[model samples]
Target chain A: MSEKILIKGNEAIAEAAIAAGCRHFFGYPITPQSELAAYLARRMPKVGGVYLQAESEVAAINMVYGAAAAGVRCMTSSSSPGISLKSEGLSYLAGCDLPAVLINVQRGGPGLGGIQPSQADYFQATRGGGHGDYHIIVLAPGGVQEMYSYTRDAFDLADKHRMTVMVLTDGILGQMMEATATENGEQTADNRQEKPWAVGGVRGERARNIVNSLYLKPSELEATNLSRYEKYKQVEETEQKYDSYLLDDAEIVVAAYGASSRIAKNAIDEARSKGVKAGLLRPITLWPFPKKAFAAAAKKARAFVSVEMSMGQMIEDIELSIRCSRPVTLCNRVGGMVPDPAMICEAILNANKEATA
Target chain B: METRILIAGFGGQGILFMGKYLAYIGMSQDRQVSWLPSYGPEMRGGTAQCGVILSDTAIGSPLVEEPDILAAMNLPSFHAFEKSVKPGGTLYYDSAFVAAPGTRSDITYIAVSATQTAESNNLKGLANMVMAGALLKSLPGADGGVIETAMKKTVPERKREMFDANMKAVTLGRAL
Candidate 1:
């Protein structure tokens, strides 16, 4: 119950972070997401929050790690190249099991690609983005309303799992306008549950909380890895949320999530008009991957086309979910190019052709 | 019904705003909508573009590659997206900026002297609003009063002076 205003996704994320009781933000200026830093820079001062524009993405993420180790809600955001630079920090945070949020408002990738909106970073975000055997809880928000809602959830999930949470979005979603807010006034989220391991010398009678991943003994590292894997499994079972559209009696299902789902929906509409049964399995949470819902979808769906802006990142998960129960095809466009509804519809029709003929 | 529109211009021409207004109108008309802008090195003092999708159904993609409508405010925008306009779609361009238009046999091309008309209304920096006006008028299936109401809703409530200039801009733009 709050007043509505047309706010950009980037700005809404920043504000939501503030609302979620996050008091520290560290980032470098990057296009399509710079508004995130700009909003924090302007407001972080008044609320006693720490906002620092580091020398680079690497430096910014490390600052996030430093703040997170002290048991505070902290975040860092960057573009594709900058996210690559922060990969080292991301991996370290995962190893330490620190609760932090990272926003990747993605643009064209592989190198210093163009700054158009793209989901090319899907593999980078989902499949253990950094090095080693670890995963960050990634959330893909498709619109402005979800942008605000997901930011609050991202912060909460980071704390809940004691892991890094990423808001994986494209530049267009970051820059678009919409009218919705989770809370009326800022500083409204009452998330300051007392923790014994918070920084500041642990107060009077608190256990020393060590926030590092430097386990020398092989047995100790293996034990930690086992625990983390169990936790990740629990997350998969409990929190794999997604949205299904027109899938009850659909023949051709379009498996798309994130920004790509927007285009896929239009294509599905066009295809449905032409008597083709096309539906969408839009993943609200990207990391957990929503296996159960999609498994149920596969029982009814004949063929699923994994539509993406990249080659085939999420398709791997879709394939893994179905386990060859039905045909899985790919419809992708890369290099910062957004595929049109006509192209996607053509791909769906082609999938239909392959399914029947 | 869904309409995908692409508005393009050189930087600082309010191309993004044009798309935003369309999206606002779409929202007011109880339609699902998205307004996506070009952000990066390409938008900072160079050619800028924004995609607006207005649909009765849920919107999936924020960016449209082959737009149903092209509101090109300058020459580069028209030249770059003239071919990308869907067959039988509409192209609303600013005659003040584009001296020569491409020959497209399939689409309806409307060349309005937008910047000049904004100048006539004592609004020099409103070529984009004019383009929005022309788009609102010429777009085959858009709600008429929804856009005008959204235009009135554009300015912040505290800044009444900004309201007059924006209304003047929209009016001059509509005239074009």
Candidate 2:
């Protein structure tokens, strides 16, 4: 057994990115996510990597764009407000087919919300926060260990699909500390500078690559979008990940993701102790939504409760996933408040009562 | 066994550090542990608190809504969190500043003059360590020696003197 070390979620994510060969990090500091930038700032120098604190979120995301265009495994992180500023850059990265990782340690709000943990950005994350019809792969982790593992996978998935990937988290998970094993983490950075599409001189062997997002011609733009859709479909087929607990004979299924899923586990355990056949279906990949898992569980589940730290945001996707075969209920706490386990247990019991009635 | 703890105090009273130390000890034991702090603008001078959960199995939630242990450092903290302790749980508080800790027969209550002990030992900032010691003494599974070792690693080299004082405070509080 490898020795486990205690690490904060933000720091773990940064280290995982470093272990995944992501060297160049361009991000502005924001509450909840500032620790990530700080960790990279301290570790990047020792590892002979670049860690630039851009002047603004706008500039930081654009810097990531420039680095990604050169085919470097670069990333940027921010909270809700800062992520809003980077929407344009994210769209541009998607359009250009540049593989870049973005992290949103979410805080509350549509405007400048408070600096507390929140999952209110669920719709924004899955439904495309940026303009245009582009989709970014979003992975939500329930704990600190997954925070590290999923970040490493986010880099791999982004590069594999040549798309933008996001690790959607909340302020609480970003600040929480937990024990995580570093067994699977790479020991050295692999910044290989060999991409056929990268905009760098070919050393007289081939034509210079021109990486761009602009398509003035309508037909060319349509073709580029169609090709991007094909890649998105491939990702949907292969990249969906989820975890289920006590779901085999579950009469009530509690659907949640990220930190909310952590709470739902406790509720499920409590409900089972009281003879309630409750289960938890946690969507690890938020973008793909794990529709099949829900569809399978819905066959036995009499009702579904979509638990979140937001006011019914991800519940929409949950309903769509199950095709509303069973009644879908929402149990949530918004504005940076976390859901209580007892409240969720109560929701499960209520759903069971409704099923019997 | 799972031990869920909630430590509450003023912003400068090292509540977050207290929880972190407990989590560090749990990690040293190779146990599944989590430490979550209450953050934001309220942390400047208002109340501060953190939750720490240690379990032999994988932890479900990092957030502790109903804690098995409550360590309060001040009057406001004591008043704010006394009722949140689970039935048959433990509540340890510093009696040096808090006069009334309220009555609750369902839970075990321990009032240690942690601040007085630290001040008497010329360790004004070691009250949190004293509480840790008291907590170690009251809990069934935790080891004081493991916590001491964890404390040594948590304290930086520049704060070597502070570590000695903290250890002294812990020893003093353990007797209570």
Candidate 3:
């Protein structure tokens, strides 16, 4: 702890990005996540980093493409709709095997969705939104602190693996008030390691590093994807994190992520007061899915309830994880809605009652 | 036992900060606590609310529909969530902003002109903290001393002036 103060989640992420040595930022404004873009726009000029609000999401991603080709630490962010426009650029980034950070402060969407928070884009993020057999390091942050930590990690991991990394967050995590002033986040604006690959005047010192993904052979593309997948598996193995609350003697466990899990924790508290042995499993990494934790918890948990903002995206992961536990149940609110704790408590009570019966 | 609460008001009223203060004190007291809010455009000078739960057991949900208590700072919030308060639950409101804070006979409603009192104290921003002190007066198991300490935890060390004002506001608001 450096100095304690309260800061919104988006501003924290921006400060973290700057501390991580990412000097170039390109983005289009979108709701729920606009605070990040705005923060970058205001600060980047003072720090001598390039901050451009591109004409559209497409243009922002393309600018990222150009910067990353030069091997510079660069980034761009958008909401779900803007993320859709950048899909083509994402595929291009994957094909080229370049490193950059992309942020999706997801809002409800299949199309121009409302500006409230939702996790419907989980499929889009984990599966790689564009048409390709490629992969990107996907990180999910549930709160304000991770909003800062993950952005820094995304940059480090992207550079280390020489691949793209996306920070997947919801509107709440992007916009919520959180205590981050104690953390030394001012470093985000000042840290940038030298990248020989970045585009700048070479001054006859060495050959220019050309960035391209135009190899015509299918085998070449397949090899690139395989290498990327291998890197992803390593990330999953070492980088996965989830939080457990009062599960030691719990008979029923509820699984939720991001902002939804916090609500679930409240429900568990309520249910336990009423004599229901409920607990919560909060996944910090949505892509890795924390299958092992779910498997371990299933040893004592009679049943697991998979809760999310979207109906069933993470439910698929939960169902595949536990072998002997009661069938997983779902509690959700879609189209920019958050699930209520009362409903969660009811589900836990009902599930516990059914198990007893 | 679970103590789930919802605190709601306009943006400047410090409702969110009140929730944060409760959470901090709950944490210091070794209770399970979480603070959650309705963010984004709704956070812009309009009705802002936070759902907080302080429990002795593992927390299952963070959402507080039919919260055990409500701290409604303004009219819109009272109207939006009044029906959700549990029977026998306590409601603390600033009579200055909320003219008719729900007429439910089952719930205990404490109306205080907190904003007016805070303005009179020459600490308008303290209106939120004033109402917060009123909550300490009304709610069971809530202590004024503990809440004062909690307010210190919330105030940034750099904003020491804000602390005296907030404490004074709390005292002034409590008298109402």
Candidate 4:
């Protein structure tokens, strides 16, 4: 246990990456998430790690792929437009079965959008941003502490699943500051699993390991994709992480993630005070989607409200998760705008009215 | 108990720093605190603001929409956030810089010439601290001694020489 320090969420993620033994960081500076790369640039060298500001987002993610293939924990971070450029590298990393961490401190976007907090990158992140039959483990951190702990655990998750682990956050969570204890007693490099398949020098000990994503043969590619899907299936079953608040007997369930979840929680509290049975189900892992929790809550929930910073992107997931058993409504603000608690509370109240009507 | 504070001013007016200092003081007292800045392409002289929340329970949203305490350091900030203060909340403004009168009677309006006090006390560029001192005095359960301890941690190590001047500015504001 270490003393709590008031730190920015971006800096907390950077510090946690170092604590998790991530030695390589390759990133291009982008708004909202620039502090993360800047922090690493200052601290990486002091901790005997490598921090390289690549010429472009493309180069940065490729650099991450290079480091991860060499059996080192490495990462890259960017905003919405920057993440689009790195999508190619993300697919390559997935195809190669490389372990790495990536961060998307998202801003509004289709291209070159405004630099404010947004959850518009939900589809780009959760549905495999690039071309391939693949999925990255997406961890959406709601607060500064989760920003720290999740980044640390992201390294382990990447290694365990042999895939990219993304800490999908928004500009608000990245820029906000909160009291967090950076040092947890359990984080050390010694706890990391050995990467025997890493393409480091074999020293003439057994066969050399090869790292490549190329499989031209149709049969081989199909087999590889099948095996990867099996891994993803297992992850969906075992790694679904979420936080439930007053959900046991609630008739209105609000499904949210990342920064929007914080707003949803506040709205739920207000709704409860108004005699509405509104609860919050915040998904910590966006890719896994916490389907079980949603399905269970749907049994008692009459309606589900998805509060998001995007134009109802996560609403599809809520509908799919519950198998459309309950009516799902969308309450959203987009283009760098965030919804206040009142707006979400109004939506919850509307859902309550609709359910009874 | 919870206090949602919104501090707004020009970028170079130490708006973000004042919010951070308050957040540090809250943390020192073992209160749950969160500070969020309104970040964008705005540079120095452009509008810069931050929200600080100090609470006893878990904080849901860090953004302060309807602030319980609104501290406006400049005219633009005062005009922008004056109406957003909760009813029965407190609005602290630097009357020297913001030259605005309160229109609402529901909220308490306290005017302090923090800018003039800082300039006279040779604490230029530290009017934010002065306003913060006034806020500390008004905040419930905030220990007066905690400000100095938090200042020790809040002020960067490279700028240790400015500690006394900052304290002096805060004291002048408190006395006023």
Candidate 5:
């Protein structure tokens, strides 16, 4: 157990990464997420860790790939535009089956939109941000506490799956400050275990381990892709996580993730007070999509409203999860603006009206 | 019970710090607290504001569109946030810098010359603390002693001197 301290979300993520045995952090500074890099700069040195501010996001993520290939727990963080630059490296990491954590403290984007909170990176994160038929395990944390816990979970999951794990959070979650409890000391790294497949030249007996994504032969590439898909399926079976609130008799269920989910919870509570049976399904694991939870929730839900801090990205997933048995509506804000509880509550009311109408 | 407060002022006015202190006080009392600031290029001038939510239950959203209490330290902030305070909520503004306090019939408005008081008392940068003190006084459930103790933890060790000055400002503001 650790003492509770008031810390910012970005700083909490950095601290939790340290606790999770991550010693190398490479990142390029960007708006709404620079605090994460700054905190790592100050704390990594104190812990004798390597904290490098790379010249750009591309260089930083590649540095992460290099360190990860060396069998060390390494990470990189950036906002939307920066993460876009790191997409190539992220795809490479996924293809190489390298265990690394990438934190996306997201801001508004299609291009260089704005630097306020926005969950507009859903498709990019869940559907492989780079050019590949690959997927990164994306964890969406709704608050400061989840920011800490999810970051720590990211390391464990990355190592477990030998895949790139992303902590998908918006600018609000990154900048928000809250009371959080962190473990006292750092955990031991698992370099020795990773050494089996690590890129360090054959030590004595075992064959050399090559960490790369390039497959010259078509059959070899197909086999690699198939194996990755198999692992992703296994992940989908085991890693679905979500928080279900007031769903027992919920007629209208609001599906949301990360920051939008936080606001949706408030709307759910408000709607319930006014005799509206509104519930929430907050996806913690965005990549796994928590299909089972939604499948179960769909049994009781009459209508659904997908709340997001974007134009609407997760709504498609919600529609697919429920198989269009119930109508799925959208309640969203875009370009770095967060929707208020009142707006979301109205969306719930509209969903209910449509369901009854 | 929950208290959703908005503290707004210029960047140098310690608006973020004011929200932090309230959050720290809530944490000291073992309550759930969240403080979120508006950051980006818009933070050009000292035009910064933060939303602080202190709740007995889990806090759903850190964003408080309509705050139970709105504390403004400058005219821009006052003008920007006056209408956002909930009906029958409390609005506390620093009269030293803000020239006009809008007339809102539903909410109770308190205008304090916090900057002037801090200046007169030779406590130059304690204006935010004074406003914070007034905020604490308005909330009946908050404990002044807990806040003072939390202030010790929140203030950095190197800036130990400012803690005393802040406490002094808090004490004076509470009296107002």
Candidate 6:
């Protein structure tokens, strides 16, 4: 086993991507996530990888699209507003059925919001940020360790699914430092899979592969969308990931993800000490949404509380996950503010009260 | 045992570095530790602060809202965070900067002349280390050897020459 080292979350993500055999990185500098690009800039060249600081988020994502079409592991990262700038490239990548990793170390948003930690971009990440009948695999990392592990695994998930896989994290997780064990030394590229459909010269072995998103015919477009939806359906059935704590007999279930889930775990412990039967269901995969876990919790839970660093954006998904069988409450902080454990404990107490009432 | 520490000072005072050192100490002891800094515009010129949590079990909520230990390196930081320490908690401040100690009677306040000590020892820009030494003296399971080890690991290789001066500053604070 590798020895644990003290590292920041953003650096962890960058190193993990390198360990996962990603050789191409294109990104624009943005607050709360710039460290990721900076780390890559310093380290990527050492590994014979390309780390290009694009002119803008739009250009960075398109660069990712280009590299991904060549069957190379590639990625781009940005904050909330920068992510909005890359939405167009996201759609193009999805429409063309390319594999890529996108990292959104989120800050508060609508426009140019504050650069503090926030999960406000939940909707944008899980709802197919760009316009289309499509979905991207979104992994919400709760801490620095997940920031590393999820980023390493995301490359494989993207390649296997032939779609974009997003590591949707917040500023707190991005900036925080913790002790974690990562794969040491330079990584070998022995694990990369061959992509038969990539846009490279066939050398007369087969027809040339064309990577394009434009379907001139309506029927072809519909068929393409249908096939993509079928892939998404398979992902939904098997890719849901979550973590549960003290949940078997919980009456009040707290549903949270990313940074909010860490705070919620503390609140659950506080509530438990105060005689409130609270539990936590932390979603690791935001796109798949962990509906099965929530549905199981709803069987024994009387109420659900969504703790978020947004204005209750994930609450809608929780409601739909359980089919509204249980009343779900929103315990949130927004505009770059994070909810403390005391606030979440109070919310849990209130939910417990309503559950028993 | 779980201890939440909040360290605050002006930007470039090594406030975040002090917190990270404490986290490293925790890690050396095989404890779960987390260090989170206050980033963005406020860190440019305004007061800079960071939260460090060291616990025996899994740590939740890396944000230290009500710190069990508060280290204020400047007057503004002391004034800003004096009231946020939990009752019966500990507060350490640089007496050379903060003219007066906190008015709170519930918590113990340790006034260390961290800045003066650092300046006198020719270890300028290391008052944060002095304060860290003072904090280590109070923290359970953190001894001089542990701190020395942590310091050796925390300080970058390029700055190895300053190890002696940093140790001198830490020893002075521990003496206080």
Question: Model 5: clashing residue pairs?
Answer: B10-B46, B11-B46
Give the Å error, residue A342, model 1: 2.2
Candidate 2 segments whose C-alpha is farther than 4 A from its true place:
A183-186, A189-194, A203-205, B156-162
Candidate 3 docks with a DockQ of 0.35
Top-down DockQ ranking: 6, 4, 5, 2, 1, 3
Query: Tens digit of lDDT per residue, candidate 5, span B1-176?
Result: 98899999888888888889888888888789999988866477658889999899999988888999999898988888999999989999999877765778999889888998889999998899989888887665667478777787678757978777888888888877
TM-score of chain A of 1: 0.96
- Across A1-357, the per-residue lDDT of candidate 1 in tens digits comes to 564656788988988888888889997998878999999999888778888989989899999988888888899998898999999999999898888999999988789987777889998898767889998888988788888888889988888888899999887788887666557426486585555555667565666677788899999999999999999999888888888778788889898877788778889889999989988889988888888988888998889999888888888999898888989989988877777788889988988998898
Q: Please provide, for model 3 over A64-118, each residue's C-alpha lDDT reduced to its tens digit, 9 standing for 90 to 100.
A: 9998987778999999999999999999998887888999988998799798889
**Candidate 1: residue B26 Cα off by (Å):** 3.1
- Which order, best to worst by TM-score? 6, 4, 5, 2, 1, 3
Off by over 4 Å in 4: A184-187, B156-159
The models' CA-based lDDT, in order, is 0.83, 0.87, 0.79, 0.90, 0.88, 0.91
| lDDT preference between candidates 1 and 2, better one | 2
lDDT of 6 by residue, A1-357 (tens): 278888899999999999899989997898999999999999999988999989989999999999999999999999999999999999999999999999999998778989998899999999989988889999998888889999999999999999999999989999999998898527545367789999876899999999999999999999999999999999999999999889888999999998888889989999999999999999999998999999999999999999998887899999999999999999998999889999999999999888788
Better of 4 and 5 by DockQ: 4
User: Which structure is stronger by TM-score: 1 or 2?
Assistant: 2
Q: Tell me the TM-score of model 3.
A: 0.82
Q: How would you order the candidates by lDDT, starting with the best?
A: 6, 4, 5, 2, 1, 3
Model 1, B1-176: lDDT tens digits are 77889988888988777777788777677677777777757665999888888887766767777799898877878888999999989988889878785698899888888888888877778777777777777555444566556776566657777667777777665665
Candidate 4 Cα lDDT to native: 0.90
In candidate 1, the second chain superimposes onto the true chain B with a TM-score of: 0.92
lDDT of 3 by residue, B76-133 (tens): 8888888889999988887887776477999988887787887877886777777777
Pitting candidate 2 against candidate 6, the one with the higher DockQ is: 6
